[model samples]
Target: MTDASLPARFERPSALAFLGYAAAIVIILWSFTGAGFSIDKVVSSPPRFADFLDRAFPPNLEPQVLARLGWKMLETLQIALAGAVIGITLSVPVALLAARGLIAPTWINQIVRTALGFIRAVPDIAWALVFVVAVGLGPFAGMLAIAIDTIGFCGRFFADDMEAADKGSSESLTATGARKLDVVACATIPAAMPAFISTSLFATEKAVRSSTILGLVGAGGIGIELKVGFDLFDYPTAMTVILMIAVVVISIEYLSGWARTKIIGVVR
Candidate 1:
């Protein structure tokens, strides 16, 4: 195609884009004012932070403390694992149901999508608190919260992947004697499997991070221990716990990312 024959560009910035930017700026300014935000206070807070950090020096990385950290770390992992598994199990069907490629029924797809959206709308900590109320304070609450969060994350991920999958394969299967479920199982699911696994790993990493804070709501994990150290004015111990959390989070992120990358490589 000649330059003149080439289609017009779709997204040259226009008044709508300018208006959106203006609205965003206004909203950002309003948000700061509404929340009584003060950049000056933030700048002034560094000394207080420095003092706190100074007090947190020589973290109590004693053998006993490290051992406790190891145990709590294991508990956090277990909670994340349980939640990821449960969330994957629950999310898969909803994802399949919401996948427009497989499910042509608009109402059904909308319903499933809306339900997943509702779950996704709630923050992990809020859900943790709710679960703590329902299940009592323990890793159980953390597990439930993580599960809900995973469902929220992975469900949408899976559904979007499924929707975007090559409909040709699934359509071809449907053209044969395949049932709707068979079409999805044989074609759509397989096409999206790698993406689903990768997304699930991402969600699992998020769950692990969130699990630390869930303990604040009595969801059972290292967070409770951290809170305890903080409440006792044990800055060294709290710092230790914080370091432990950072270590685990980084470790999980690296490990999961490596695994996902390897899997993608293998699949390709």
Candidate 2:
């Protein structure tokens, strides 16, 4: 094809494009002002941060404190694990309903998609607060919040993964006199299992991180300890809690990554 026959590589942006860009810039500036962004505060923050570090040094090493924190951490892990399992289990069926042209009708798919979106729109912390009020502030409430959050996280990805699975195998199953559910069971779900596992691992990691802070709202975990330490100016204990949370969260992330690689590799 001659250069003259080719389409132009660059064209002037439309007036609407310029208007959109200007609007984006204005919104950013407005957000900065609304969020109370201050150059002076940023410049003056170092000394205050240093003071925090000074007071937080020499983390509490008391055997009793360690034992107490250990139990709380264990509770947090339990909450995360139980919640993730429940959510992931529920997500499979919900995802099937949300997967367009899978086992569910178009209207069912739309409804399920909308419900998943609504679930994801609300923050997990807000869910925790709601559950705390409902369940009277305990590990159970935290677990419920994590479960709901995981459902939102896993359901969306699971549905997309199933929808993107190899259509050839599913079609073959359907053409062999298989029912819609049979086709999904024999072909679609198997094809999407690896992605489902990966998403579940990610959901578990997220639940762990969220559960750590759920205690701040009295939903049960090390967060309550951290809050109490800060409230009483027990910097050493607070530092210990912070360190523990960091270690656990990072460890879970690394483990999740390793599992994803190994499991997906094996599946492939």
Candidate 3:
């Protein structure tokens, strides 16, 4: 209870930790300089942005334009849904292999985990570019990109969730002479299902956002429309595209959050 027995208010950082902090600060400053950070530009950006707002205020709300954008938005949703389904389906097997102490051996688990990490490290846009080359510029390419990206996103989380599942059930099943796959199907997967559902919902949301930009690389979505608008300096149309994208993305996010909460609550 004495002052000497109480923990120190602030422990001094280690020499290595201090050095790491200093190095981080230096790197940040170096990056800012390299990236041309400028207070003058920041201070003067408002008028330029205001001018852009003036040009974009009258959103191109023509009925035909709205219909076209609506169709494209629907296509974007389709891409996201199809890709999410494929990726989430594939993630199960991939995660089974990646999960330590699950179906795959430690060596196999490490390799699969490393592969998933590599997949995740590459941006979805980069994947879209690659798929565009392979599949010839369309929603198919965008779907493939979203699928790969979702697999990468969901696989890691799925593996971790499986690995963290209540081992007691698996152990009991094993004691009853159940095979590894049986134990996984009945015990491990069931235990991790809630987390899997939550993760899948997030993957869908992510796919939607990624799909929109995939069109920029000719991977197919409304991105091409946005690009064309900007290229032609059609600011009004560009603003409309931006607004449509915002609405769709926000709506999907809200729905995903609601689904996740409901499902998780039911599970709990």
Candidate 4:
């Protein structure tokens, strides 16, 4: 082959790229130090973990224990379902308002987007504590926490989907003397509905996972039962509770994955 026809030698990344990588490493190390990371503590972790395992052996397989765990798991799943429904219902309109391409008013879109941000800022666990204070414990608090988080989680994505919708359809409808609401209903919403449904399904799965931990704040679910086991130093029971939760979570995850595939033709 002629020298001119030879492929150019593959070049290494520039020094600037290496410098950027070095800077990122430095920042990560600095943050790790500030957070008090320690190799010595990590090295000593396995024995403590082993002791935990020793205590957690011989899982609690009693009928009453199994029944209680089953009931709590059911409660958690119900809370997640209810929260997802409530959140998706509430998010749809807000998501529409936040879609800048659909809503021409810049101020309104910005405000809606900002509100979604604020809603998503607080974690579900924190929201659970807040609701626990407001509602005085039980599944209701967890439901509300999950609902609020779902609104944030699904709304932002739904808004983006709405915004990403083809403008030509919306414009064509509007040109035919269609009102703004009609235009969105006929053009944007239908286009985005599948994506919205898929997002809601994912959000429901996320809520199911969050529901497990809400019991930490006495909001309700299997977490409270697990807490009691740990508090009593009943590691066998705790392990049983953990396994029960794992089974339920995995089962629901599989079910949701299958549903998503059927409905949206996507696994995730």
Write the residue-wise lDDT of candidate 3 on 1-268 in tens digits.
Answer: 5666868999999999999999999999999999999999999999999999899889999999999989988998899999999999999999999999988889999999999999999999999999999999899999999999999999999999999999999999999999999999999999999999988988999999999989999988899999999999899999999999999999999888888878787422
Better candidate by TM-score, 2 or 4: 2
lDDT of 1 at 95: 86
- How do the residues 155-178 of candidate 1 rate in per-residue lDDT, one tens digit apiece? 888999998877889888888889
Q: Write the per-residue lDDT of candidate 4 for residues 43-102, one digit (tens) a residue.
A: 999999999999899889999999988999999999999998999999988888888867
Model 4 reaches what TM-score against the true structure? 0.92
For candidate 1, list the clashing residue pairs, or say none. none
Q: Poorest 10 consecutive residues of model 3 by lDDT? A: 259-268
Best by TM-score: 3
Q: Give the TM-score of candidate 2.
A: 0.94
Best to worst by TM-score, what's the order? 3, 2, 4, 1
Q: In candidate 4, residue 1 scores what lDDT?
A: 60
Q: Which segments of candidate 1 are over 4 A away from where they belong?
A: 1-20, 266-268
TM-scores for all candidates?
A: 0.90, 0.94, 0.95, 0.92
lDDT against true structure, model 2: 0.94
